[model samples]
Target: MSHLVLLSGWGCDARIWQSLDGHWPTGVAVSAPDWPGYGARPPLDEPGDLAALAEAMSAALPTDAVWVGWSLGGLLAGALLDHLPAPRALVMLGMGPRFCHPQGVTEAELAAFRGAFRRDADATRAHFLRWQLGGEPAPRTAHRRLLDLLGRESPAATATLATGLDWLASLDVSRVLADPPCPVWRLAGEHDPLLAPEERARADIRLAEAGHCPMLSRPEAVAATLADIAQRPEHSLLEATP
Candidate 1:
C-alpha cells in the first residue's frame, strides 16, 4: 500500500494537518512528523546542516511514501531528495525552488527578520504567523484557523527558528527539481502572495480561490485534491503540464 507523508512549513508542527482530519482518503497510511527541533522533536546536533537534518528526518519518513511538503517544508523536502533515498513522489506545495527572490522577500528583508527572531523568537513567530495569511479571502478568519491548528506547540528554539530562516534565505532546489530522482509535482494556491511568478507559470496544479494557506482555508478541497493525486500512477503525472 502507498503511504502519505505530510510535511508542515516552518513555525508549524504536525497539527498543521488538523484540517484534513477525517478527510484523508481511506487506506493510505499517514505520517506527519515535525522537523528536528520543532514542536517536541529534539534538535539535531547540527540543525543547520541540510545533510544532517535530512538524515535525522529520514528515519521517521517512509521512503516509498508520496511526500507532500507545504511552503518552507516543501522547499526543504526538495533539498532532501539529494540526501534521502528517492521518495515515491514529491509534491511541492505553495513554494518554489527559492523563497528569497523578486517574487518573494528580498535577502535583506529576510536577514532583518532573522535578526528580529534572534531578539524575540516568540514575538517574531506570532508576527510571522499573522503575515503568511495575507492571501486568504478572509485574512482574519484564515489566521484564526491557522492558530487553532497550530495549537499550543511552542515554536522551535530561537536558534532553530533562525536556522530555518537561513535555509529559506539561501537554499535553492532548482537543480534537483530540474531532474528529480522520482516524479515531482508542484502545486500552488491561486492567490498565494508568496509564490514566485516563475513558479506560478510552471505549477502543475493551481488550487482556485485559494491562498498561501489553502489547506487551512480549503481543507476539504485540499484533501480531495490529494486523494485524486494519490490515484495517479506512482511514477507519472498528467500529459498536460500546467
Candidate 2:
C-alpha cells in the first residue's frame, strides 16, 4: 500500500494540511500527525535538534511511507533520511534546503524576525501566517482557510517557536538535494515571496496561482502532484540506460 505522512511547517500544526483531507487518490493512505509541542504532544526540551526530533518521530512514523514535508517541515523531512530508516522517498512543497535566500527570507530578515518573536511571539507568528499567504491568487480566501484550520489545532509554545526559528536559521540542505539518498521531488510556488526553490526544480514543479501555502490555496493540485510522484518508480529503469 502507498502511504504518505505529511509534515507541517513552523508556526502551524499538522492541521495546516487540513484542506487536503479526502483529496488523495483511492488506495493511498495518508496521515498528518503533530510534531512535538504542536498538538497533544508536549514541547521537547530541545526542539532545535532536528536529528533528535526525527529520531523521536521514528517511533510513531513508519519508515516505509513516503514523507511529504512543507516549508520548515520539508527541511526536517530531508534530515530524516540520515537519522531514521529512509522513507520510500521525500517530497518537498514550497520549500528548499536554504530558507534564507535573497528571493525568500534573507539572513537579516530572519534575524529581525527572531528579535520580533522574542519580544512578542504571538504578534510575530500572526504576522508571519498572514505574510506567507500574500502571494496566493486569492490571498484573503487562503488566509481565511488557514485561520480556520489553525483554530482547531493547539498553538506551539513560544519556546518551541524560538527553537523552530533557530532550525530555520541553521538548516541548509544543499548537499542532500544535490545527491539525495532517495528519489526526491521538489515543488515551489511561482509567486512565493518567501523561499522559492524554482531554479532547483523543474518548471512544471512550480504550482500556478499559489504561494508559500499552496496546500491551502491549491489543495487539489497539490494532492494530484503528490499522488503522481508517489506512484512513480523509486529507481526508474530509464535512468540505467547510458
Candidate 3:
C-alpha cells in the first residue's frame, strides 16, 4: 500500500484531511500531520521553527511516499522536497511558490492581514476563518469547528510560525517546474483570496470549487485528486526517473 502523507497549512491541524477517506484510493493509507503548534499536539519548546520541524519530519517519513500540502504546508513541501528519497508528488493547495513578491507574495494587503494576528488573537482567529473561506460568510458554526482545532494552540506558537513564514515567502518554484524533481500538482480554489489562479500557472493546477480552505469546504474533490495521483504510474515515474 502506498503511503500518502498530507500536510496542513499554518495554524491548521490534521483534521483538515480526516474527512477525506471516501475520496482516497482504497489501497492507499493516509496520514496527515498537525503543524508544530496546532491541534492537540504539544507546542515546540523555544523556537525550533519550521526548518528544524521539517528536518524532523524528513527523518520520520517512509522510503516511498507522496506529499500533499496546503498553503504554508505547500511552501514547506517545496523547500524540503529534496530531503527525502521517496517518490515525492506534491499537491499544493491555495498556496503560491513564494509568500512574498518577486519570489512570492507579500502584498501590502496581505502583510496588513498578517499583522492583525499579532494585535488581537481572538479577532485574528476569526479573521483567519473568514479569510480561509475567501471572505465568505463563515458563520459561528463554521468557526466552532475551526476553533475546536485551533483552541489548543498557543499564541506564541502562532506568532513564531508567522515569523517563520518569511522563509516560505522567499522561495522560487519556477526552477522546480523547469526540472521538477517530482511530479508536482497545484490545487487552488477559484475563490481563494490568498492564491489566485493567475499566480499558479506553472504546475498542473486544478481549480476546485471553494475558497482557501478547500480541504474543509470541498474535501471530496481534494481527496479524489489525491487518489488519482496515488494510483497513476506517471506520477510515480516523475519522482523516480533519472
Where is the poorest 10-residue window by lDDT in model 3? 134-143
Count of clashes in candidate 3: 5
Q: What local lDDT does model 3 show for residue 188? A: 70
TM-scores of the models, in the order given? 0.93, 0.91, 0.79
Poorly placed runs, candidate 2 (over 4 Å): 152-154, 196-204, 236-242
Clashing residue pairs, backbone N/CA/C < 3 A, model 2:
none
Scored by Cα lDDT, where does model 1 land?
0.81
List the RMSD of every prediction in angstroms: 1.9, 2.7, 3.8
Clashing pairs in 3: 99-105, 99-169, 100-104, 100-105, 101-104
TM-score winner between 2 and 3, please give it. Answer: 2
lDDT of 1 by residue, 1-242 (tens): 55778899888888888888888777666788899998888998988898898788887767767789998999999999889998777888898888887666778778898888888888888988878888788889988887777764455787787788888988899899777887888888888877766766678888888878888888888888776665577435533222
User: Measured by TM-score, how close is model 2 to the native structure?
Assistant: 0.91
Angstrom error at residue 240, model 2: 14
Specify the poorest-scoring 10-residue window by lDDT in model 2: 233-242
Candidate 3 global lDDT:
0.63
Best by TM-score: 1
User: CA lDDT, every prediction?
Assistant: 0.81, 0.79, 0.63
Prediction 2 global C-alpha lDDT: 0.79
